[model samples]
Target: VNILTTLILVWYSPDAKADAPQWTFLLCALGLFAYQSLDAIDGKQARRTNSSTPLGELFDHGCDSISTVFVAISACIAVQLGYNPSWMFFQCFCATTLFYCAHWQTYVSGTLRFGKVDVTEAQFTIIFIHVISGIFGPSIWSTKITSLDVLPLRFATVAMTIVCGSVSLFSIFSVVFTGGVGKNGSTVAGTSVLSPVIPLSFVIIPACIICLKSVQNVYENHPVLYIMAFGLATAKVANRLVVAHMTKNEMEYFDSVLVGPVMLFLNQYFNFYIDEYYVLCLCTLWVIFDLMRYSAIVCMEICDYLSIDLFHIPLVDHPITQLNKNGTTINSSVVNTGSRQTRSRRHHH
Candidate 1:
């Protein structure tokens, strides 16, 4: 399946080999569609045949991740070696990082969920944007202003790049701080205690700047790209708010309603080209990290159900723990139970 997926991706990849004819792009697209179709089939096969072992699950995920990376890289290379701007490759890299950060944030929070019945707003938007851009290309909406002709497509590309860069930076910081706490408690590098203020301050300041910039761009140019960029930035900020609130309060359906539109908007506007191979590779690494983390959680849950004790698990030695210990009988079972309860409570919402 992995080999098949790779071959399909390569064939569908827009990046043309110097030795190959121009018709290869068409062949590549067809192969990509076939590969995607097979992606669905493999999952069904695993379920129907009762072959859903941990290794099988891992392999499936690995293949999916690799295929995505291959597509991204191919797009980048196609642009680099073909008709697209060279700088577009950098944009692709940033976009891939943005995707990874979003994925990481969800996985680390233990709220990672996947489905086929429902299309995620991000996925839907991206697919829509790809189709529209492919059909319309550079002539989507052309307007002229005082000695200058502006293309909406170019604006869209630029806006997407800016949004991708901003979001990627935000995601990197948020994931580092939050995931650090999850893995090592309040302190990072065994020192420098992390406070709510640290992350909140870091995230909010830059977010405010970006939002203001986006708003300014919208007012000055009123380009469709700026609007889309603003939406992406707003959605990311809103997501952070939702996550923080979820940590403290109940999850609400209304929150989804509020945030869903921005995600949908971003997905529809974000574009990928053959010039972002490096960026796509980086995203693949990010996805691997996320999948590994998710797999770790799954393994731990399985161990708990099977009554198997994994050796030497790292425990977060928070200040609260020190305060709770008062030279009383150190009941190991009580400690374990307390830890498990706390973890469960943290993840429940």
Candidate 2:
């Protein structure tokens, strides 16, 4: 999805590849509108059912994470940032990095707050920006902000960058102060007591690579980059799921709003090419496979969580028996006696 969405921008960039027709904006706007509308309903439905499971949370965050990239691509298109690499890097960095910061915040603070406007809330606002740009033209965002006289997009992007930057800074520093009494009498490990860096490297390393490659554009084929990025993204999401499950914490998904403007700056200053399709295919397929594997693991874990039967029904009954060549007999009672004894010696979820 990361590669696909990025390609969409490359092909449609009027200033960069210029492969897309003039009507690209209409198509993109409509797709974004439909997606955002449907996205809004998912949370409502989850609430209506009063069932918020790990799967639902994963689905929500997974979609939001992927869509965050798409939103950046679209915003860059709207602002005519296709030919600017510096801005492109900044935009991608802003979106991806800020989001990672949000998760990190929850991990350290043990709480997630929106302050009235969160990523999802800002998503609709961004969609509105795309719609206006699509209709009145991308130039609208470039128009100066009244009184301030700065370009609207410029002012908005700078303001967002500052605010989100501060939040990220706070979260990063909070890691050092985490240990204390937690909900349900659980101990919250503070950075002073312990550092989750090793485990968290599973989250940070790939993120750094993604933001770096997005800025560099050195790979003729982006397979290595995309595969690493997607795999890490999924793992990071799963990490949150596991932590939330074990800690019984709740979190919300959000995207950094400044990616669009940062992308504009990158394009305006140092435009680079990212249309390496074959490499993208490799990366996308790898991530898709990773998700499949992740799903299987999750299913198994869920079954274990519920203590659902995994072995055949015959194993549940004592009468089912198998006779060996001579006189030996294998039955559920004998099999379970040993297995159950072994299992009893271990721990369970």
Candidate 3:
């Protein structure tokens, strides 16, 4: 829903201009709030349905990885940061990088830690920014504060993100460098502590180099597309990190999702045989498909191996013997009906 609403806003204001209609921002706020509410409840729902498994954790974090990208983009658009593609780029990548670092540390520490001011708070802050933008106007972000430097309110978000990101990075690095649960202070998969950086660089390095070197200014012209492509690429790697943590498997540095960025980089290297914008469009499409395909395949594989269903609660009914009023015994069998069954087995799908 958040992605859909963001697309609507993009349609209304392709560049997220300050003069875009107020309704677009309101829609974005509602969508993000809905996303946050749903994300919070999903775990509870899983536990309630007795379907909680390792797969549930994987799926939850996987969705979060993808949502981080959309939320960051929407937030940047809400603040009219598209006017400054550099800041917009930093904001979006900052979000993805922080998210990746969180899991990267988890990959080492074998635990997911949340700080006092964590994801929930950050999400609410973005929602508030959307509300204010919707109520006042996107132009309000450009209003200069009474400071010696006369900074815009939008720049305040950049400052806050930098501080928060710095603290988070510090905490994550402390965990990663200190040691892992494995022998000799390695990662959970017993790989090098610094191995995760290689995949991350595959996303960030190409993004910076390609965007900076593009003769056609593809990124500056279409910041949303460029960011979304790289964002999904980043999410793919982050998801792999989660998988590695959960399964205790070594994560390879090379990822198929890197193909998208590589294409853009090669296009720049070739001096734009084809239009860079078209390549970006193709890159976006490919990354979206690749993420979905990989996620679906992984979920299906896990479900099959665990004898579980991804979306449904599996119920097994057992027979019960009851005593009759007349002192006779009555035997009743609980059939394998649908979800309304009153009896369940020890193992759930």
Candidate 4:
């Protein structure tokens, strides 16, 4: 599945066939949707049959990360070939990395959720928008009103920009805080001893500066891009906060202190910290954290499936379990017996 997805992306990439027919773009868009759907199916099948393994989970996420990278690369090639702005490609790439990192960290920590508003849900929504707008060229349809055509392209572009931009900002913030405390040198902090002020400043001061610059850049020339960037950053932060709060962990205390003070500081000193170094450092840290998260997720999945114990594995002690009507333990022995009974019942029925 991963190979096929990559092949399709490469074949339909902007660089693959210069001046390709308009229909090819639609084909590429459709291919991406199909790839994502197939990716989802493998996992769905595993869970439905209760055959899910750590290996499968690891492969699924790994494939997803790789597939996203291909999408970004294809976008970059397409943009460079004059299909879209280069910045759009960069934004998509950054957003994809941040989205993966945030979700990967949350998943490892056992704090990730699936619902109406979460990373997974948001991703599907974004992809849907991309597919629709990419195919139809972002024109809205209205029959009741006059011959009104909504330019979906503008909205879709802005939405993509915002989702990616916000995620990148959140990643930068988390990296600074985590790096300041020297916990894994990534956003996945297992511990921290720094004062709330220092850590918050490390994270927020830079984020504020980037966001301000991003806003100014938009206001001066491209307001639409700016809006999209801001929206993306907001969504990423909001998603993180929701997951963090929902986990109900002791770490929430530290995060609460960190988030509040930093936000306050950003509001107070929005203009004092703009510089290239800050943006470079934040982006660099984000990349590092994203790579680590991707690798860690893959490793954890492999270890789980093979039942191999690794000293560095996070959340390994909390293996997923099932419960019965009486809420008692359901061990492997019980699982086997239950399977046998289920099979017999199916035959009888």
Q: Count the backbone clashes (under 3 Å) in each candidate.
A: 16, 20, 0, 8
Best by lDDT: 3
Can you rank all candidates by TM-score, best first? Answer: 3, 2, 4, 1
Which is the leading candidate under TM-score? 3
lDDT of candidates 1 onward, in order: 0.37, 0.49, 0.87, 0.41
For model 4, the superposed segments whose C-alpha errors exceed 4 Å read 1-17, 74-86, 107-109, 114-159, 163-349
Instruction: List model 1 lDDT by residue over 45-161, tens digit each.
Output: 656443444444434444443344444433332322223333333443344334434434443443433433221333333434334434443233222333445432344444555
- The candidates, ranked best first by lDDT, are 3, 2, 4, 1
Worst 10 residues of 4 by lDDT: 340-349
Candidate 4 lDDT over residue span 247-320, tens digit each: 32223323222332243235435653544334333433444354445456646755775775433222212223
lDDT of 3 by residue, 239-309 (tens): 99999999999999999898888888888888899899999999999999999999999999999999988
Model 2 lDDT vs. the true structure?
Answer: 0.49
Model 3 spans with C-alpha error above 4 angstroms: 316-349
| Model 2 stretches astray by more than 4 angstroms | 1-11, 14-43, 139-159, 168-284, 307-349
Query: In candidate 2, what are the lDDT values of residues 118-161, reduced to their tens digit?
Result: 66655665566566665777665566788778445544754675
Q: Give the runs in model 1 whose Cα sits over 4 Å from its true position.
A: 1-23, 76-86, 111-155, 161-349
